[model samples]
Target chain A: MVLASGSMALATRTERTPSLIGSVWRSTVGKKAVMAVTGVIMLAYLVAHMLGNLKVFFGAGEFNHYGAWIRTIGEPFLHHKWFLWIARVVLGSAVVLHGVAAFQLSRRDLAARPAKYAHARRRASYATRTMRWGGVILALFIVWHILDLTTLTVNPNAEEGRPYENLVASFDRPPVTALYIVAMLALGLHIRHGFWSAAQTLGANSPRRDRLFKVLANALALLLTCGFIAVPVGVMTGVVS
Target chain B: MNLTLRIWRQRTADAAGAMTSYEVSGISEDMSFLEMLDHLNEELILAGDEPVAFDHDCREGICGACGMVINGQAHGPERTTTCQLHMRHFADGDTVDVEPWRAAAFPVVKDLVVDRSAFDRVIGSGGYVSVPTGSAPEAHATPVPKPVADLAFEHAECIGCGACVAACPNGSAMLFTSAKVVHLNALPQGAPERESRVLGMVGAMDAEGFGGCTNTGECATACPKGIPLQSIATMNREFLRASLRGGRGA
Candidate 1:
């Protein structure tokens, strides 16, 4: 019997099929964790971007210099615009991951409730309900925003180095300004629910901390919305040009 | 009092269902929601018609057996089990919509009866402790903190009624799953399998085809047991801890 057991022990060993990371990404809870992490990364970037955008109110020279200074960040260790490119890569990856997880989760959610209640009633808050549509709007806005500002592709008065003039040119038209306003509002609504949701997903929210997280979410959403909209409103009123 | 009921009527599991209207008269305001339904069923049975089929075990709210979406709300508007919801909340001539719990994991069996064995599977995964079988130990032999016991008891109130699934827009079972996970995980008795318990139950939940949570708060709001939404957060914390510690071998 000992000899037989020893012989059986020599058989090929098997490793776990799905690795820890593989299972984590595949599981719904883990996918939500991914969304939460990536959402925080993008949110941090937006705060910086919004602050940088506010530099335009100080006049063209300061704003343009601020834009140029960002390219030269990490001066000696990193080459010119390397920091910008790196940030773009990180932010782009965050966006893709956030979007893919959201898409898959949304599909699963819809499929889970195939039969709608006959006595249809409105469910969830307005911000919660608008999350999907707002995410799509934000995704589209990112593309258009890159084209108009970063790449100088769609800006009517495109120039290589003058971000301040470019900003004024993009917001000059009423339709463009209106679109910006609508997108900013959508951004606000998205952040309103998203920040609190991220806290919950990350296990940071408790019954005691719930109120504080809600207040922070509301404050962040309101601040970003008003700050971004102020730019186009300024352009419309001839304050930045 | 007279009332109109637009109850979902399906012959079998595969049969197409619809809202079949029936007028029920002489319903006393003191009658529970299930009692009113019983009144309707009695009339139908007397008329030589197929009586409405529903699930009800204890007729008491504690059993967690009776459940139906009453007017688009799970277990009705009063935030209690269907068996406990009194008819006084409704007025004469009111129309009520009764439907079974809706979720991919919970399929309709008959009229207002859903197959909730998915929850059983989830529970079977890891919702228990492996204690040594013998004569029971002395009462205070295993010391437990008062707060910890209270927390465990709080989550232990879950009746497995699936109201959370019905109320959730996404039909997510996170609330239900979290309640079980938290209830067991918080206790010292559940310590031996803490990591494995969370990993196993969460895996089973996903396998059951229940939706992922979106933190909509609807599930907690509609919960007849009043299980807090924070339970899911605690489960999330547990899951992350288990995953980080590599809950593979156990």
Candidate 2:
């Protein structure tokens, strides 16, 4: 018995160890973990971005200064606008990873059940069902957002380095404001489900704590939605102008 | 009462399957779903046609042997097993479409029957205690807290039916695996093998081609035994702990 057990141990030790990271990426559970981590990273950025947008309420002087401050972050140690570039890199990577994981998992799910159900009924919520479409809308919105605000390419009245003028110009148009509002609604729904899902996937949910997590998820979704829409509403209502 | 049935017919696993409609008369409202199918099968046999095949045992909903997607819902429109669903849920002149559990891992064996041995393999990986055959131990030898015992029992109610897989859009098996893991790991006797059990079972689940849980909560809703969605969350916690402890080098 001892000899057999020793041989088993020796065999295990001699076997080529699989790459841990590669295995995790391949497994469904591992992909879920990746989604949860990347989702949390994006959620954190949203909160920070929302807070930064709130600076507009303080007037153009403070708002534009805030934008300039972001560029000058880590000054003396870092070159001009280096911090902003670094943030873009980090946020960009997180977005790509989150999107890739979601897309691959969705494909796997579809492949798992090739045949369509004849009388399928939904047992999940509206937000859960619309997650895939909401994600697509948000992705498209991000591109339009960057083009309108950062690049000044889509903004009809493009102003160089004038953050407040650019902001007002973008939201001044009814079509642009309408599109932003719609995208924010999708973002709200996405966050509503994604927040709680991230908690479940990351192993933070418990029977006792489930209610608390749900409440927190709703509050975060509401806050981010209102926060983002407040800026466009402010411009449309002439509050910020 | 008369009912129209659109049942999927297939000869073998590799054979193509399609919906074939049939009409049945004099199916009593009191008859269970399977009994109604039996009536249909009896008619088919008398007409010199192959009887429709389906899986069932105990006819009482305990064995988890009966499963099918009825009218786009797993186990019909009711929140119970197909065996427990009675024909009274349907109205006269109603048409019902029945198909086997549609999943890549669960291929149709014939008509309404699909292979469910994937679940067995998952359980085989690590779903039981390693107790040897011997005399039973004293009842009071291992005291269990009432709340813990109740939670474990609630999870233990899972019948290993493939409804969760059928109801899920992604055909994920998280709910089934979670039920098994939580039932055993929550018990004192199952403590020693907790980490290994979770790691092995999760590995087996992925190997079976099941999708990851997106927290859609459909599995819990479609579950006949009323297994709560919290079980999946609990299992996630267990898996995270096991992985952190270097199980399977995860």
Which predicted model would earn the best TM-score? 1
Candidate 2's C-alpha runs over 4 A off are: A1-20, A74-82, A157-160, B248-250
Cand 1, B chain, TM? 0.98
Q: lDDT of model 2 at residue A121? A: 64
Model 1: CA > 4 A from native = A1-17, B248-250
lDDT of 1 by residue, B93-204 (tens): 9999999999999999999999999999999988999898999989898888999999899999999999999988888999999998999888888988898888889999
DockQ of each: 0.70, 0.63
CAPRI quality of model 2: medium
TM-score, cand. 2 vs. native: 0.93
For B29-112, candidate 2 gives per-residue lDDT tens digits of 999999999999999999999999999998888989998889988898899999999999999999999999988889889989
Tens-digit per-residue lDDT, A65-106, candidate 1:
998899899999999999999999999999999999999999
